[model samples]
Target: MEQYKGRAIVQKIAAGRIWFYTKEEQSVKRYRVEDTEKEWKRYEAARDEAVRELNGLREKAVRELGEINAAIFEAHALMLEDRDYSDSVKNIIETQGVNAEYAVAATGDNFARMFSGMEDEYFRAKAADVQDISERVIGILSGRRKRKKMGKEPVIVVAEDLAPSETVQMDKSKVLGFVTRQGSSQSHTAILARTMNLPALIGVPVREEWDGKMAVLDGVNGLLYVDPDEETLENMRKLQKEEQERIRLLTEYKDQETVTKSGRRVRLCANVGSVSDVAGALQNGAEGIGLFRSEYLFLEADHCPTEEEQFQTYRLAVEMMAGKPVVIRTIDIGADKRAPYMEGEPFHLEQETNPAMGLRGIRLSLEKEELFKTQLRAILRAGAYGEVSILYPLITSVEEFKRAKALLKEVEEELADFGIPCGKVRQGVMIETPAAAVLSDLLAAEAEFFSIGTNDLSQYTMAVDRENPRTEEYFDSHHPALLRLIEYTVKNARAAGIPVGICGDLGSDESLTEFFVKVGVDELSVPPSRVLPLREKIRNID
Candidate 1:
């Protein structure tokens, strides 16, 4: 038996036969159109057909997969209806006199090319979605078969890449796991696996010899075992049984505190993005809400959300927590994010070559004080309902922390003068940079609390973008240097007598639970689905 290593996106274990999948390539042929008006009509008709198909797929996906999976087709429907996409195709048809199929292909290629050239990997991955949507329209225009060839029995699908639309159409029951050569944690394929609770490995090496072979997809370690020996197979069975039992055992601790065997207690919280997720958190036994990402409010709106609108949302979260602490991270938008609502003239998101290091997080908030203050006032007012803490993201220095706090105080005093009811709220900063870890001593001295934003911390410290597929070979969360930075940040917070928590993706990892506990991490905030299991793991730790 030999192990093939890859980056694990969904860390679950599954043993199954391998099924290699390759999508049929669509041929793009340029042909002249005799009538531009007729071509335009054809394109419009195809687009309408595409939208209808997407809507049908959305309903089927909701019934079979779930709401989140169905949302993919919903997005596809929106893309098909987008004026920008339609305008591009219409212009090509009218100006160049190209046939509908050729016009669609050209416009799709241009859009995909734009996305492919983007610096952000998430945006880069979206090129496939654009192509997938165009292909569907083209297929409608040309009468091509577009259905996927799924297996009869469950199998682990190995592929080069799976587009969002393709992933939505997949048979959920037959897909045991996924091993893709081109994908990241943020990719749709990975997201689907995560939602389905399936093992998934991305950036897997291309291997043709292992097809139809029995293999163990060890997603926890990102290893693929091809035709394992008797002893190794037995060990894998034992481990799988233990994991199943652990999951079954975790249900008993649904309402219990996360106290270790030696009586060490830590607050277990859930990282939520929207109000809808709050119920899921409580259902999974989250003691509190650790990280409430506030960027969605901005992203979801055409303009800046009013203080009243933001207040209503924040209040809902605060009241839902019901006096339990809710650390709401202020808008962490950046140039790389390129939010749809913020794409217009008033919002000037710079196109930086290194968007990750450019204007983002606290920097953007400090610069766009008007937008930032709206959220501050809303959060402060929400605190009046229940326990609400403000968390500033990507704080790299003492000055940024102080400036943000000063702004918070300014808002508080402004509200006080107006006699607008606002409560005393705790303030904190996300330690997500190398400098932040090095200078945690200075920042923690002033902040009320700290949350280690491990995703950014890993990216900035290692100088590696986890979203980028090329960096998969070198992106190691278990790297000694990254762990030390986390340790250093935790140590400084502990010495300052302020609570510190890890609110990054790595915090949800089951293997690191003991390491975090030993380092005196005050809390572990993860996704709602992992809260119960993590609590169980914490309870099992000595």
Candidate 2:
């Protein structure tokens, strides 16, 4: 028996034979080509073919995984048409007088290297994207398909790494789980695995010889047992049964109120990125929509989503909640979450040395008045359909909060002037920074409610970039200082006679549930899947 430890992407258990995924190798051979025009034409043909394949995969991703995940392939398609990338391939082929495949391979390597060398974690992740697209085009040129076929039965797929496109193209039914030798938690493969609700592990030392061997993938413990002994298998089966029984028991609490043994009640909500996530929230008995991340509607688009587009999306979410209160945060773009279209025209976002602390959230909204007003109008209009609260992100001071509210009021007046029916929206502020937490009392006086964004609060309070892996050890979400901030924020909110909720990763931490309840947190909002488990935890607390 062999035991290996890895990082878990999704917490689940699966037992199956290992299947080593072998990608078709495209060995590009460099050769002198006399006909430069012919080579350029060949490259163009391959690019077109690759785009077609990407589009097909994108459609599949949309049908299985929603539009947000499908955006990965859309990006690959756009990368194929990027002028710098395509121009480099053309230049190498024409000037160097080399075959199209070799030129493409060379261009991919150079671009991937450049991206890999970038300091920003987001940009560094793009290096893998460049390689995926490059390999795709090269495969087309070489008349080979990059996607590998699975066997007849389900198996645990073992691979060095998987591109987003490759993962989406696989036969999902044939896949029991995934164990990769190399991948980060932020990798698209990890995201896809979570979306697919499949158990997955990364950073495992996978071996080709382990193929076809019985394996137990214990995602909860991040362990993989290859050809495990009888006793190990028995213990694993017992654990799996317990997990299944635990899940069954959780359903009993789904329809029950989230109240403690002492009869203390709290609102348990879900934070969703898109409208499609609302169904899951309802299934898991989310009392309301806590943090509706409105940025996704902008991020997934090639251009700025018009006021009507944003309105429809927001309206759909509100309506889906079926009269449940939905708190919609305004477009929180910039920093890691960037829209390419915003880089041009009137909404030009300048490059920043420290983007995380730069123009983002409410700052970007305030700087771009028209953009801000457009969203405010949509949220107000969506409010007519159902209960909707407009929450502004990154509120560092009272002045910023007042300025944002002033704009919202102006939009309401504009709607009234135009004789448009606009519903009243509850105003709220996101206490994400130390300044915001300290000034919560003043802001809460004017704001209807408060939502503590613990993710950024911890980051800014600790002066650590949460997304940067190097800062992982230092980035403490449960730091004493962060808890003090949350306690302070909640205390202020209570004094101001306004409810306060947490809408960050920390809200989902079951270990902190009792602490939050004890701190007088009015609500705990987390991902849809965590709602029931959190509710179960809340019920057990005194």
For candidate 2, list the clashing residue pairs, or say none.
none
Superposition TM-score, candidate 1 onto the true structure = 0.65
Clashing pairs in 1: none
Model 2 Cα lDDT, one tens digit per residue, 18-87 = 9898767657899999999999999999999999988997999789656855677888899999999999
- For model 1, the local distance difference test gives 0.81
TM-score of each: 0.65, 0.71
The reply for model 1, stretches above 4 Å from the true place, is 1-6, 13-180, 184-199, 204-245, 296-309, 416-419
Q: Who wins the lDDT comparison?
A: 2
Over the stretch 56-135, how does candidate 1's per-residue lDDT look in tens digits? 98899689546754666887789889899999999999898889888898887899788768888556545656776888
Q: Judged by lDDT against the true structure, how good is candidate 2?
A: 0.84
